[model samples]
Target: MNHAWIDGRPGSEPEAVAAAAALIGGSRLPVVTGLATDIAGIRAALGLARIAGAVIDHQASAAIYPAVTAIRDSGMMIGAPAEIRRRADRVLIVGDAFATSPDLPDFLFRHEPDLGKATRGKREIRWLGGPESSADIPGAIEPVVCPADGIADALAMIRAAAAGHRFGEGPIAGEQAEAVAAWMKEAGFGCAIFAVAGMDELAIEMLAGLVFDLNAETRFTSLPLFGPGQAFGAALAATWTTGFPLRVGFGRGFADHDPDLHEAGQLIASGEADLAIHVSGLAGAASPEPEWSGRLPVIAIGGGAASWANPPKIRFDAAMAGRDHDGVLHNERFGSFVPFAATQTGTLPRAADLLAAIAAALGDVTTGAAA
Candidate 1:
């Protein structure tokens, strides 16, 4: 089966790779986005971007950045899933985190805490700033329903109360905030879980500050939910390689980090990026067409059998990790890389292999030009 395409026409894999390399070789500025691959694939992308002097961005950078920036700007106390599962006696969930997190149910209900309060025994779950009903959840939960826009103010009040100070007026009443703070202070170990999507940087920083304040009296930490793609994995790889997170550029022959300047969507929309290389190799639901599609020339590498709604100019299919081949991926429960065996073997190309091939082809193009 022909797994490559040029201008939407079927072609051999080598043809697609050569065409993609030619485009990258000729472009003044290329943006590599849609980084939904595993660690190896992301590292290969970083290598390609360095070689081609491209800007690197992940599809979910918007969701991942708030937490990252908050942590970088103001240090936060964070813990892994195993730590929360084993010892966290009180869990304070903020925003629609539970709705977005698929493993929240398993974290909340599937397992019992091993070390907690001797008096209560079971963990106490309190949800803040989301739906009013906890009916969807399996266990008993106390819901502090606040308006979506008022979450930041409510968190501020909570932070004040946690710090033994009183706020006269706020989104959350002084009495309620104090009551919540009292509960938090009574915990043996506390954990605050939040999702960064649709949340502003200030709000995330406030939540982190609240966790920090809570830590003054008792052990407290926070966990941020990741994304629709392998955002955390990509960010992790980028941090280690470039000394920065995602949204890095290599145009100056060294890695430079700038969240606003290197954003893929803005770069494509503003006509700064002449070409875009999109890599989406994770298997599950259909990947959404990027909003910046058709704005510039594009080379797309997608999951083995997945097809895009808006096909780019050049396309190549690659094997998906954990589905078509054995691979390592970030596990939220473990808060680390974990290996998974492939459910089925496939002859399709791997993303890392395809990316390495494109990089090699780009090198060949540069060598010919120099000669």
Candidate 2:
């Protein structure tokens, strides 16, 4: 196993673990953010947060807030990626869905006949906002080119048209609105796809409302694109363990979740957190670089070389979750847990192992202090 580091100096794993424990155990306010590891890593992070009285937040929670809020507020009719691939004959993409998942075209417009049962009719792909890019698959139609800020209004017009109501003189032309309404009327199984990143809350709400409205006449559902990381898995784990989503604080001697108040970025920026532990060991996941002028002490455990604008106080090169260690992950396509096997073996320690070591060291420090 490789030696971890404290203040850019190499040290034994035990030394680094004890130093990390001391830093966190003495802090009045500690935060555990950048939760991008697999399920087991998330469980360990939650346990450490409970012991340290820390707050937990994922790095991508800001990007994911729109979808979460939309689903929480008005309720969304959502389908899995596989379900959309199999059954959706008409696809309405609100923004550049390819930005989140580049393989979207292959998933929606693949030529393999044996992949699944083919739709009875030709698949219809339509774009609502932005100029169509070359990434657009064959036979895609763009009826409107609203600015990113205008998507909400455009979707409102579409929803009004779908509901036989008047949205007078909106960004979408009457002819285009009628055409989309006609498609909604004729679509056998329709799906609306959008990337949560770069999307506004109102636009997401409007998109969900549009899908819900279409359900009155035909079968329609929404699919939010999720990339390769533990953001979704971490949210699920937090919900199950703490009965709340991310941005949860344990400082009150219990789990208290407030998306706005306890957000990782907000807390760090406001100098509310004196110490932070960032855990991000998923394969291909990037480490988070929190921006704060307070020069807060940070203990980072993750894969990849550590290169932060403001270097952490303690750093550990942990094993990649699914590639270097085996664990379970939340499958967004099926809304279930799936076993992820280790594809590579190396001397690097897993995040779970490092976290448990830190927790044990912290416990020893507390016991010594009490005695």
Candidate 3:
């Protein structure tokens, strides 16, 4: 009677759909709808949850919603994924690293690091020789490897130097930052890829302002990596539907996004959020303890085969976003959507489908009302 024991049950769309319907008090029968999320794994959960008439929440909730709020409060620009893959001649990966970014290993060289016919090529206007030696040094684009801890001073120093003001002049701050500032001034078209590792949520808006300032000197842009899995989709969808992304809640007949109030972990820990419809594929298991996982009615959804032999109190299994589900993901390169596919062979659904279903089921609930 309990299909939860079926290993990775959601590997099959049919099973995923059935599981979703169960969560939202729907039937086990088939449902045709679209669930979409910019994040990879959560996309599938969205599809499943929508069919289930359950709420849709992406795993990226922890990282993205805050950034979305910051962006809303401050303001942001537009530079898509295609731009990175095609036009990013010089790429500066700051703060964090992409887990499986295909473009990494010698991507920005005069020609892409390729062995096709042993031919060397240079795509960009000029080829900056050698690997990136520093983050502060201009044209010396490189990965920061800050691991979420060593970002603040580096960012702060860079910001100060770029602003033509001297902030810190220590070993890592003096020559290092000035070098990067010089590079920014020299770069024809540059983009800085930032992530939430070393800095807290409060620093995001300031980070945005810093990036914007760098632009005054040259082509400086910032790409904040939401997190593993479809970080962008969950954040973006929630924001679009309710004016805020990720950690937002619809328990009060209106969707609301707030760090102090809307964080999923905080809300659940405080007994604020009920009927949590969690979406993730990073790790298919849910929290064992209510405090750890948040004490609430959770409809956790995920990708691959169902990993939990016995899911959380209330749960559903979904498909993969990048590996299996058919949908779009924001490329870490330029903030554009990159569409990937999945099949019945591998488990994956899209957040769009799931959200659509939930919207359909909670028909009377306005996007704002869901807040």
lDDT tens string, model 2, 107-154?
Answer: 555642222322567677788784556445656565457777778888
Q: Tens digit of lDDT per residue, candidate 1, span 66-180?
A: 8779877897887888878878778888888866676566765556677755135788888888676667665578888788888888988988888887577877778888888
Candidate 1 lowest-lDDT run of ten: 302-311
Per residue, candidate 3 scores C-alpha lDDT tens digits across 1-371 of: 23232223323344444444444453221121112334533443433333333334443345455566677778865455444444444455554334334354244333432322112332222111122343323333343333344455566776788788957543253766776667656655555555543246555665677668867766556556655455565566555555655544333445544555545455455654455555444332332222334344444544422344434433344444555556566555545556656544553334445444544544433343456
- Local accuracy by lDDT, each model: 0.84, 0.80, 0.47
Estimate the TM-score of every prediction: 0.94, 0.91, 0.63
Q: List the residue pairs that clash in candidate 1.
A: none
How displaced is residue 170 in candidate 1, in Å?
1.1
Q: Which residue runs does candidate 1 get wrong by more than 4 Å?
A: 116-120, 304-310
Worst 10 residues of 2 by lDDT: 110-119
Clash tally for model 3: 49
The local distance difference test score of model 1 is 0.84
